[model samples]
Target: MHPRLKAVSFAVATLLAGAASAQSATHIAVTDAPDAQSATADAPASTALSRVTVQGARVRELPISSGALGARTDLETPFSTRQVTAEDLDARQVKSLGKIFANDASVMSLGDTFSFNAYSINVRGIPLDDYNGYKINGLPFFMTTVELPVESFESVQLLKGSSGFMYGFGAPGGIINFVTKKPTDKTLFSADLGYRSDGVFSEHIDAGGRVGDDRRFGYRLNLTHEQGDTYNGANVQRNSGSLGLDARLTSALTWTADAIYQSRRVKGGVQDFFLDDFNGDTLPKAPSGRKNLGAAYDNTFFNSNVFFVSSGLRWQIDPNWSAKVDVSRSQDRRRYSGQWMGLLNGAGDYTVYLNKAQGAATYEQAQALVEGEFTAAGLRHQVTLGLAWQGLNKQTVPKSLYTPIGQENLYAPITPLSWNGSYDDSLQYHNYHSAQKAVFASDTVQFSEQWSALLGLRYSDYDQTSFNTAGTVTNQYHKTPVTPTVALMFRARPDTLLYASYVESLEQGSTVGQTYVNKDEVLAPLKSRQYEIGAKHEGRDWGATAALFEIDRGAEYANAQNVYVSNGQIRLRGAELNGYWNLPAGLRLTGSAAWTAGKYRETDAELVGHRLEGIPKWQGSIGASQKIPGVEGLSANAELHYYARFDADSANKYKLPGYSTVNLGVSYETQIAAHPVTLRAGVDNVFNRNYWGFLQSGYTFVGAPRTLGVNAKIEL
Candidate 1:
C-alpha cells in the first residue's frame, strides 16, 4: 500500500463508523438505558448533560449543556475552549492523541517520539506541560515516559487561555483536560471493529450497566486489541483494558472505582519521520533528503497499569444550598527497555547509540475536597475549596545491547538481535523521583442578575532528586508558588453576552525548568497572564461570537537556540477572531484566524522583533458541511489551515518562511443492521505542496499524506 493511502484509510474508516453509530442507536437497547454512555441528550427533557465524571464526583449535572462559548463550542467565548465529543471521535476513528488535534489551530504538535517522548502540545503558544499536571481520575498517568494511547479518553477538552485557578498551576497559553469515560449507571454495550491503511486492525468491546438488577450498583469494562504498521512501516501492536464501577449508597451518597491495564509490543522509532512543514502548506511533503522512518529497536517496553478508587456524597443540606465531599487515590506503574539506533553519518553505514536501557516509573496522587453551590440575590454561586497532593518515582538500568562505532563489534540493520548476548553490562542508574503538593480554592460569585465574577488562589510546594548508580548523588531542589486570578461576565441580552477576564497561572520549574550548574539559575516557575473579552449571540439555527485576547509568558528553556539568553522571558500578544454561519441554502461555514505580535524581552540576546520560535504569526482554518438532496447520506467537506510568516529561531537571526495547506474529504454512509456504515476518501495536501512547519537539526515530523478508508459501527 502507498504510504499516503495508509493515512487515508484511517480517515475514511473514522467517518463511516461515526455515521453508523449515530443512526443505529435509536432502535437498540441503547436509548433504553439512561445514564449509560452519555446517551443522546436530545431527548428534550432538559437541555442538560445527563452525567459527568468530574473531580471524583459522578453526578448528573446540567450546568454545561447551555451553549458553546458558555456551553458549546463558542468561538468568541473568552478563554477559547474546544471539545472533541465522544460521538465525533467515534465517527473519526481517531487513534493517536495527536490525530485528534490535527485540524485544530489552537493546538500545535511538537511532532514525534524521541525515546517514545510523546508529541508536545502547545496551548496559547506555550508547552502544555505548564498547564494542568496530566491526570486520570486523580492519578498521574504521565508518570511513565511512554506513549499513552489516546483511546482511553472518551472526549478531549483543550481550553485555551487562563484556567490556572482550577488546577493551581498552568500555562497562560491554556490547558488540555481529558475526561475519561466512566461506567454507565444504566445498561449498555458497544463493540467496534476497524482496519486502516497502515495495515492496522483493531477490535474493541466496551460494556457497562447496573452490577445487579437493583440498579444501585453499576460497572463498566473496556478492552482493545490491535496490530499494524504506522506511516513509517514499523510494526505496531498493543492490548489494553480498563474496568470501572459506581454505586449509589443513598440518595446523597456514592462510591466509584476504576482500573486500567495494558501490555504493548512496539517498534520504538527505528527512524521517526517528519514533514518539513505543517502550518503553511495545505499540500504536504517529506522534508528534503530524509531517510524514511524506521523502527530498529531489538527491545520492548510494557506500559503496564493504572488504577484508582474513590467515594463521595452530595448532601442537600437545605433547599437553598448543598455540600459535596469526595476523596480518591491512584497509581501508575510501567517498565520498558529498548536499544536506540541512529542515522548514518555522511557515510552509508548505520550507527548504534545506547546498547540497551531499562526504565520504570510509578506515579501516585491523592485528593480530598469539599464544594458548595447556592442561590443568592436572584443569582447562583458555586465554589470549591480543597487540598491536593501528588508523588512520582523513576529508575533505570543500563545493559549493552549494541556496539558503538568505536566499540570492537558493529551493529547491523538486519532483523532485531540480542546484540547484548553474553555481554556484561553494569546497572548504572539509580535515580529516585520527585513529589509535589498544593492547597487551592476557587469561587464563582454572581454579583448581579446580569453578571458574575470569579476569583481563585493556590499555594504549592514541590521537590525532586536525581542520581546515577555511581557513588555520587545530586542534591534536590524545591519550588513554591502563590497564584491568583479574576474574571467577569455580563449578559448583553437573552441571546447575547460579554465576558472579560484577567487570569493568572503558574508552573513549577521542573520538567525542563531546572539548570544543574546554578541552583539560583534554576528557572522560577514560568508565569502566564491573560486578558480576554468576547461576545456570544444565537437565534434559530444561527450563532456567532468574536473575541479579542492577549497573553504574556516568561520563557524557561532553550528551544535549541545557539545562544544562552535565548531562554529569556518571552511574550505572545494577539487577537483570535472566529465564527461560523449556518445559512439557509444548505451551507454551513466556520473558520477562525489569529494574529500574534511576540518577542523575547530578557537580556541583550540576538533576537528582537522576531515572532516567538516555532509559532506562526497568523493561523486560522475554515471548514464547511453541506447538505445534498440527490445523494443519500453523502456529504462533502473541506478545511484549510493558513499560517503566516514566523521566525524559525529566537534571535531574529534565522527565519523559516510561512506556508498554507488544504484538506478535503467526502463521505457516503448509510445504516446497516441499524448501525451506520460509511465510506470516505480525501487528499490531505491537495496539491502535494512541499514546506516545513519548523526546523530543528533539520528533522521534521511530517504531515500525514493522502489516505482513504471504510468503517462500520453498531450500538446497543
Candidate 2:
C-alpha cells in the first residue's frame, strides 16, 4: 500500500478503537429532539440524535452566513438562498454537486462528475468565479477543479445574486458555503457500507463525542474510502479523512479547529468533445453514454489531492454582544493526462490530441468580526463590523504539451495513434498571485413592528499579478472599489415577509485560453448590479417563496476573429417559485419552477439581441415522498426534472434539444441486535435516456445512463 494510505488506515483504526473503548466504559444520554420550528436553535445536538434515513415531518430551518453581515435565516435575509442538510444527503446518497442540486431550478451543471476531473455549476445563467465563488465556514478557499467530500459537512448553503457588500469580490451568479460538522454533546458512532452498479463499493465511518474531565473538550472524526469500476468503463479510487476539535476554556469563551484531507484518482476517464470548427446548423446525434471511444492502452488518468485547516475563537461579551476571529489555509494539487477531440466537419469525423499538465494552488485567509444589538433614538438597531484579508498563489508547468495523435469517427469508432508523454514536476513555476483586503459594516434598523431597513457598505483593495515561464511579471492590476447594498422589508404577518433589495458587486477578470488569439492575457475587472423583489411565507406544515430579479453584467467572450476580449453588456431577467407541503396521510410534495430571459444588450451590433448560450428558457422539478401506512419505518420518493431547448453558441446558429429524467429511491429502518440499522436503494435516469448534459466553451458532454446504488448503515 502507498505510504499515505497506510498512515490513514492506521489513524482510522486508532480513532475507532478509542471511541469503542470509551463507549464501553461510560454511558452518555442522548438529548431530546428539538421541534422543527426550533431546528436552527440547537442544531448540533438535535440533528445528531435524529433519524436521517427518511424525510422528516417538516423542513428544518437552517441558518446561513452572509459573510460580514453575520448569520440569518431565509425569512430574515433579503436574498434568494437554499440549504441542503445532512439528512438530505444521506437520504439521496448524493456523491457529487451535480446530483445534490439535480432538482434545483436555479442551478445547472457545467460539467459531469464522471467525465471531468472536478465538477462545476452555474446560477442564473452566469458561471461562478473559481477563486471567489466558494467558502468554507464563511472563509475564502480555492475551488477551481476541486470537489469536497460531502460526508464531512453539516450542510451546504447557496446564496443567489450579487453580494458585493456581504463578500468583498465574487461572481454575481452566487456563493456556495460548506458548513463543517462539529463535536456533538453526546457520544455518537456510525458506520456505512455501500455499493453501486458496475462494481463500485465504499465504506465510511463517523464518530463524535465530548472527552476530557467535565466534558470540556470535544472531537469529531470522519473517514471514507471508495474504489471500483464506474458505469462508463472508468476506474476510480478515493480516500478522505477529517477531524474537528473544540475546547471550552470558560463559560463565555470557546476555541475550535478543523482539518480535512482527500486524495482521488481516475483511470480511463471520458474525454470532452469540442465543436469549434463545425459548421452544422444543428447538433449531431449523441452516442450511447456507455460506449468507450478510447483505446485500451490509452494512457489517460486524473489525480487530485487537497488539504485544509482552520482555527477560530468565539467570545460572548455580555448577552447582546459577541465577537469572532478565524484563520485558515488550504492547498490543492492536481495532475492529469487526457485527450480532447475536436470536430473537423459536419460529419462525425474528429481529430484527437494529447494534453498533459500539473499544477498547485495555495490560499490563506484571516478575518475578525463583532456584532451587537442596541436601542438608540427610540429605534432598535443590529450592527455588524468586520475586516478580512485573503491571498492566493498558483504554480503551473512552464509549458503544457498539446500534440495531435490521430483521427477517428464518432459514429464508427476506431483506435487512434498513441503518443508517449508524461508530466514533470521539476518544470513547475509560479504563474499567478492575487490578494484582497476589505473592511465592511452593516446596520439593520427596526423602525416599527412591521417595518425595517438595512444598509451596508464595503471598501476593498484588490491586486493581481501574472508571471511568465521565466518568472518575470507580464501583467499586473490594482483597484480600490466601494460596494453597497440597500433593502426595505415589511412584515405583513408573523409568518410572512415582503421585501425589495438592490446590490452591486465586482468580479475578477477572465483569462484567455490557449485556443484564443489573446491567450494568457487577463482582462480588467468587471462590475455587476442586481435588483430583486421577493416574498416569503412560513406556515406550520407548508412554506413557499417567490422572487423576481434582473441583473446587468459586463460580458467577455471570443469575438468573430477568435480573439477573446471584454466588450458590451449582458442582461438577464428571471422569476422563480418554490414551495413545499407536508400533507396528511404521510405524503409530502415539493416543487420549483424558473423562467429566464437572457440577451446581449449592447456592444457588437451583430450579436445584439442574441440569446445566451447554454442557458435554457425554462426549467423545473417536482418531487413526492410517501410513507407506507401498513409498515413502519418504510418510505419511498420519486422526482422528475425538465428543461427547455437552449442555444448552443453565441451566434445562435445551433441548438441543443432539451430532455427529462427521473429518479426513484426507497429506504427501510429496523433494529438489529439492539442497534438501529437502515437500508436504502435507488435508481437514477430510470428511462435510460441519452442526451447532452452540459455545454461550455463550445464543448459538449454526454449524460450518464441508468445507474443503481444500495447501502446499509448501522449506528451504535
Candidate 3:
C-alpha cells in the first residue's frame, strides 16, 4: 500500500481501538427497523446535551434529509456531511452564503460576492454556481441565475461527494441543501437592526405561529432590507420577503407552500477583470484594491421573484411498511445588467462594455417512496423503493451588441463613457428544456449489532433540447444512465463509526464558455466517480470526523486549433479533518484542515499534469470562542483562514500568491426594557490584507477589505 494510505489506515485502526476501550460502558443498536431508517426529529440525550458550548452551541444532532438517504444524523451516515445552524449564523453574523464556508476547509469560494449575482463556489474541487447546484427542502431552487433569500432558511447543510444517484443530473461538486424555517408550534416574533463599517444599514423582522384551537395550521413570514456601501467599495441595495405555510388536512396528509421575493441592485459595479484580453506570459499587475475603475454611469442589477408549493402524503400500509408521496413546483424569474473589463496596455487603458439580459426558469418535481423491514435467514433488512421525476424549462434574452466604453487611468481615473440603455436585438430570445425521470431502490442489511451495509442503484432517462431566436430547434440530447452506490459501516464503539463508500455521478457535459468560438454548443452527459473512507465520532461534549477521498470528472479545454472540446480529464485527491471541542472552562475550539492535489490527467492542449485553475493545494482554518470569565452575558471569538498558492489558468504559467486573514468578534446577551436582546460586533479581514481572490473562468477580483459590522436583535 502507498505510505499515505497506510498511515490513514493505521490511524483509523488506532482511533477505533481507543474509542472502544474508552466508551465500552454504553451500547448502540444497528438494527434494520423501518422506523429506525425513517427520518425523525428524536435524538439521543447525549447529542442534545452537547449544544451548550461557547459559540451559541451549534447543534450536532440535527437530522438531514436529501435524495434517497432519508433523514439521518451525520454520525450514522456513510458520507461526509456538515451543517451550520441558525444559532451559529446569528452568533457569527454571517453576511452571505459565500462567507459561510470560511470555517469549512473542504469548500472554497471561487468568485467575488460584492454582489449576489456573481457568487460561485467549489466543493471538493468541483466548481458550481447557483444554477444546477442548490436545493431547498430537497427540491430544486434557483442559485445560478437567481439569488436566494438566505434569511428564510433555518440551516445550511452540505453533502460532499458525488450525489448523482440522490439528485439526478447535477454538478459533481456535491449538494447544498437549504432547510427553510418552518412554522412554529407556538407564537414567536423578533426584530433586528444592524450597521456596517461602510455606512450600510439593515433591518429584519420574523414572525411565526399556529392558528385555530387544534393548532393544525402554521405560518411564518420574514422581511428584510439592507443598503449601503459594501466592503469592496460597491453601493448595494437588497430587499427580500418570504412566507411559509403548512396545514394538516388529516392525520396522514400535509400541505406546505412557500413564496419568496428578492432583489439586489448595485449603483457602482464591482471590480472584475479578465486575463484573456491581456497580452502577457504572466498575469498583469493588479491595480489598487480600493480603486473604483468602473465607468460612473454603469450599474449592475439583479432581481428574482420565486414561488414554490409542495404537498406530502404519508400512509401506514401495515405494521412494518409505510409509503410517502411528495410533489412540488417552483418558478423563478431574473433580470441582469452588468459588465467586466480587462486592462489592455501598460498605460492603464482597458476595454469595458455594458450588457443587459433577462431569464426565467420553472422547475417541477415529484417523488414516491415505500419502505419496509423484514428478517430473512437470521439477518435483518430494511428496504426502500422510490421513483422521482424533475422537469426544468428556461427562456433567456441576451444583449446582442458589445459597445466598448473607454477605460480610465489606474493612478488617476475620470468618467470616460455614459449609457442610455440602447442596444441592438436586445429582445432576441433562446429557450431551453430539460427533464429527468428516475427509479431507485436501496437496502440496508444488518448482520449483527456492530456491522451494517447499504446497497443502492438508480436508473434515469434524461432529455434536453434548445431553440434559437427564430424558434428553430438548435440542439437536442437524450440519454439513459444507471448509477450505483455501495457502503459499509462498522460501529467501533457506541459513539464511533468507521465507514467506506463508493458513489458515481452523472452531469450535463461541458458547455463551451462565451470566450470560445463555439460558445453555445453543449456536449453529452459526463460520468464521474468518487471513492472515500472516513471515521466519525459523536460524543457528549465534542464531535470529530476525518476522511480521505478521490474524485475523477470530465473537463473541457481549448486544443491547438483553438477549438474547445470535452476530451479532457481532471482528477482531485485529498484528505480532510474537521471537528469541534468544548473545554471545562466554557471555552470552545473548532478546527478544519484540507490538503488537495488537482491535476489535468489528459488533454488535447499540452496541459497534461498542469494544476487545475483556482484550486488551492492547502486550505485550513481554526477558531476559538469563550465566555468572559466575569461577565455572564459576554463572549469573544476569533478565527484565521489560510490558502496556499494556486494556478489561475490550465497552462500553469500564471499563479496566484498564497494569503491569510483573521476575523474577530464579540457578542453580549441581556435584557433591554424587559425584552431579551443580543448585541454583536465583528471585524472581518482585520488587517485589510490586499490580495487577488478567485481566478477561475479567466477572471480575477480583489478580496474584501477590513470591515466592521454591528447588530442587535430583540425578542418580542
Candidate 4:
C-alpha cells in the first residue's frame, strides 16, 4: 500500500476511536445564515448529556428558500442535500466554485486555474456543464462559459442525485440552487480586501437595507473587482456588479428585480493538454506548475450583461392550504474574443485558433404550485402540485481564424509569433431555440411517527429547433419524457434515519462535444435512472451520512463501422461516507470518502468494461479546525485531499498519476474602530507537490503549485 494511504487509514482509525471514547460534548445544529462567529462561542457547562438533532428534523426550520419545493428542512427532503453557508465562504476564503467544493468527496473540479471564466465540475462521476447545472432561486439560469457571481448569493444548496421531478431536463448529477441575498429589514454594509501570492488584488463591497419606514422596499447591491496574475502565471482582470431590489405590493404579493454585469480579460491562458499531443502512449512528465506555455499574444475576453425580473404571489386561502405563482424573464448578452492555444507536441509546439463571437440568449420562465396538508386513510400527508414553463432563444455568430504558433521548449519558452490577419469564413451563423413545459406532483405521507414515504412524478414536454444563417429551419425535435421518484424513510432512532430511493432524470440532447464522426449534430434526449440507499444521523454537535447508489445514463458513440449512433449506455456504482463533528472545546472535524466504478456498458467491443477516463476509484478528504486556547478570537485549520490514479483516455492507452495535497488556514476576529473585523490567511499545496489533473472529457492539466492568500473583511 502507498505510504499516504496507510497514514490516512491510521488517522481515520484514531479518529473513530476518539469519537467513541470521548466524554459528553456540546453539539449545535447548523442553521441557515448563521452569524459568522457563533460556532466559536464557548459551550455552556451542563451535567446531563444532550442528544443532538438536526435543525431540519424539528418542526421549526431555517429561514431559507428550498428550490421548487419551497422551504423545507433537510430531514423533510427525500434526497441527499447539503448547504454551504456564508460563514463557510469567509472562513475558507473561497474565491472560486472549484475551491468551494474541493473538500467534497462527491464533486471533482475540472477547470484549471487559467480557465478564467469557465467553471465545470463532475458530481458523482457525472459531469455537469455550466449551462444546465445551475439555478437562481429555482429559476433555471445558465452560467454558460462564465464564472458564477458567487458574491451575490446568500447560500448555495445542493440536492444530490436525480432531480428531474423538480427540475425539467438536466444531467442526473444534481441540482445546484444559488439563493441570492435578499433585502433585509435591518441595514447592512460590509467591505472586503484580499491579496494572493500571484499578485492578485481583490476588492468587494456589499450593502443592503430597507429604505422605507414601512420596510416594504428593500435593496441589495454588490460590486467586486479582481486583477492580477493567476496561479498559472497568466494575467487576468475581472469586474462585476449586481443590484437586487424587492417591493411588497400587498400582503400576499411581492415583486423582485435584478441587474448584473461582468467583464473579464485574460492573457496567456492555458487549458488541458490532450494525450495525442505527446510522443508516446505513456503519459509524459508534466511541465512546471507555474509555467505559462501559451503564446504571449494569446488572449481571451468575455463580457456579459443580464437583466431579470420576477414576481411572486403567495396566498393563504385557508389554514390547511397555500398557493404560489412565480414568473420571471431574463435577457443576457455575451461576447467573447481571443485565440485558444493547445500544445501540439511535448516540445511545446502549439496550435492557435482565433475565435471571436457575439451571442444573445433570452429565457422566460413561470411556475405555480399549491401545497396542502390533509389526512388520508388515517395518515397525515403533505401534497404539492406544480406546473412550470421555460423558453430559451439563443443566437451566435462566429468570426474565426486559425493559425499555428511555432515550437518552443517548455523549459525555455519564447515570444509568440505574429498572425497574418487571415480568417476562416466557412462557418455560418448558428441559431437555436428550445421550450420546456412540465407538470409535477409530489406527496409526503407520514404512515406513522416512525415511517414515512415520498412519491413524485413529472410529465415534461420539450421542443427544440435549429435554424441556418438564412433563417431556414434545419432541424426540429418534439419530445415528451416522464420522470418519477419514490423514497421511503424510517426513523431508526430519534436522531437517526434510514432511507431508500429510486429516481429517474431527463437530459436534452447535447449540442456540444463533437467526438462522433458527425460533428455539431445534436443528439436525442437522454433518460437516466438512479437507485440509492442511505442513512443519516444528526446530533447536537455532530452529523454523519452514508449512501450506496447505482446510476445508468444513456450515451452515444461511434460504432465499429464508424457510424455515430445513440445506442449506448454508461453505468456507475458508488458508495459515500461523510460526516462532521464539533468536539469538546473548540475543535472541529470534517471528513468524507467515496469509491466508484464507472464503465461503458453498452458500446463497441473495444469500449465495453473499460473504466471511465478521469474518474478515480478511490477519493477521500479530511479537514480539522481548532480554536486557540490563549487567544479568544483566533482559530486554525488544516485539510488533506487524496485521489487515486486513473486513465486519461477511454482506450486506456494513457495513465495519469495519483496525487495528494495539504492546505492550512488561520483566522482572527476582533473589533477595529468599533466595527467587527475578520482577518484570514491560507496556503494550499503546502508541499508543492506536482501532479496531473485529469478531466472526464479526456483533458489533462498541471495541478496548481504552492500559493498563499489573505483577506480582511470589516462590517461597516
Which prediction has the highest TM-score against the true structure?
Answer: 2
Query: Candidate 1 lDDT, tens digit per residue, 641-715?
Result: 676756554544434456676766555657777864544444455554545444222233344443333344455
1-716 per-residue lDDT for model 3 (tens digits): 23444456656545434432211110111221111121111110000011113434443354576577665567668888777656666766765667656688878876655543355778887876344578877777656545455666666787888887777677777888877667776677888888875777888888888897688887877788888875445676778777777776766556666666677666665446666666656554555455665544456554556676666666667778877777878887766556666656555556775655667788888998887889999999888789998888877764334455666554566475777656554464657778889999888898888899988899999898888878888889898888888888888887788888888888876556555677657666667888878888877556677778888888776665556678768888887777766666778777777888888886754888888788889988877778888988888888888999888777776677788989888888899889888777888778778777774646677666677877788887
What are the TM-scores, per candidate, against the unseen true structure? Answer: 0.76, 0.91, 0.90, 0.88
Model 1 TM-score relative to the real fold: 0.76
Candidate 2 per-residue lDDT, tens place, 1-716, comes to: 22322333333223322321111100001111111111111111100011122335434444567787886777778887777766667777877766666656888888766555345888888888878888888888788767788787767778888989998889899998877777887787888888886777888888888889788888888888888887777887889888888888888888889899999888876667777767566667766677676552377787889999999998889899989899999999988777777777666777786778788999999999998899999999989999999999989887777667788776786675767656565678888999999999999999999899999999999999999988898989899999998988888787677777889999888867556678768787788988877767666556666667888999887788988778988988887667666667777677777788889878588788998888889988777778888999888888787888888778777777899988888878789999888787888878888887564657777777778888788888
Residue 237 of model 3, lDDT score: 77
Q: lDDT of each structure?
A: 0.50, 0.75, 0.69, 0.67
* Residue 301 C-alpha lDDT in model 3: 54
Point out where model 4 deviates above 4 Å.
1-68, 250-253, 276-279, 299-309, 316-319, 331-333, 337-358, 424-430, 514-517, 557-565
lDDT of 1: 0.50
Superpose all Cα atoms of candidate 3 onto the true structure and report the RMSD in Å to 1 decimal: 5.4
TM-score of 3: 0.90
How are the candidates ranked when ordered by TM-score, highest leading?
2, 3, 4, 1
Residue-pair clashes per candidate, as listed? Answer: 37, 0, 4, 5
lDDT of 4 by residue, 290-355 (tens): 776555555555556665556666666578887877787766666655544455554555554445
